[model samples]
Target chain A: MGLVPRVVVDVMPKPEILDPQGKAVLGALPRLGFSGVTEVRQGKRFELQVEGEVTEAVLADVHRMAEMLLSNPVIENFEVRVEETA
Target chain B: MGLVPRVVVDVMPKPEILDPQGKAVLGALPRLGFSGVTEVRQGKRFELQVEGEVTEAVLADVHRMAEMLLSNPVIENFEVRVEETA
Candidate 1:
């Protein structure tokens, strides 16, 4: 089972939620001379390696995991993208 | 003063930092049939519109802000790139 599986999951807090980290970072732009940057939202990207054909079951499971465990459903939304063999 | 400056700030936690969120997402890959990706480190990308010429001084200020305020240097490293007028 040397098959290497990779997955990229990108998740971000919804616009309504207050992302202190993102806000603090966004605010610092002008003071640092990055004057025109606006609307900075922080997110997550994940890459993984797995085994088996890319099936709906696998995608569903990953999505479920993201919604129920990996990310906070109340404030964060996640997207899971799967890729096989690099 | 309608010049637009776009800045992409990509920052990531140093390898040593334990990213639970990233790890959880990485772990879910096999369950999702994504079996080729490895070493997924999360980072930030900032796009901004600012006013002024791309000068060394501007770059320096952005760099300093990223290090001192925007990003947590103890756990994060960032790169500031500036583009003027779209």
Candidate 2:
């Protein structure tokens, strides 16, 4: 089977921003008997399957998508990268 | 500044499962004038900061944590990896 190129965009909350969801997870870990984890921050991961070769233009478009829709620039930072191709 | 070891855990919905959030993003992309992206999948990324060195035992514990707390094995798949260390 032919797989299309895939791009991954990760959106994480800004360091100074409060991550309530991550805090909840952190609170639950030790209760579940898991230790050594001192902090937890949760974010979103997006996998985009594109129709053609992943060129510079494609990556630039992906970056635009990340900034415009996948993440909120005011509260989050996003990273875009080509994950795989076929 | 001293940086601690960090482990990343990614939890994605099983391919066969319907992802309404991803669907919403896919539908919005074209309306925003971004094309060529045929599909989109949204998932969760977790960054865990550990208290000390990331050893084999730490990784094993993280794997167990991923299986038990980070993902729903019945409908989601999870990956755990050590991202960076200090």
Highest lDDT among the candidates is held by which one?
Answer: 2
Which 10-residue window in model 2 chain A sums to the lowest lDDT? A77-86
When only the first chain is scored, the TM-scores of the models are: 0.78, 0.92
Candidate 2 residue-wise lDDT, A18-46, digit = tens? 99999999999889999888889999999
Q: Estimate the lDDT of model 2.
A: 0.91
Model 1, span B1-86: residue lDDT tens:
57555555656677789877567656765676555435555555444333445567756766776677657999977768765542
Candidate 1 TM-score for chain A: 0.78
Q: Give candidate 2's fnat, 2 decimals.
A: 0.88
In order, the Cα lDDT scores of the candidates are: 0.62, 0.91
Docking quality (DockQ) of candidate 1: 0.29
Candidate 2 lDDT, tens digit per residue, B2-67?
Answer: 765689999999999999999999999999999999899999999998877889999899898889
Show the lowest summed lDDT stretch of 10 residues, model 2 chain B: B77-86
**What iRMS does model 1 reach?**
4.4
Can you list each candidate's DockQ? 0.29, 0.89
lDDT of 2 at B84: 56
Per model, state how many residue pairs clash: 25, 0
Off by over 4 Å in 2: A1-4, B1-3
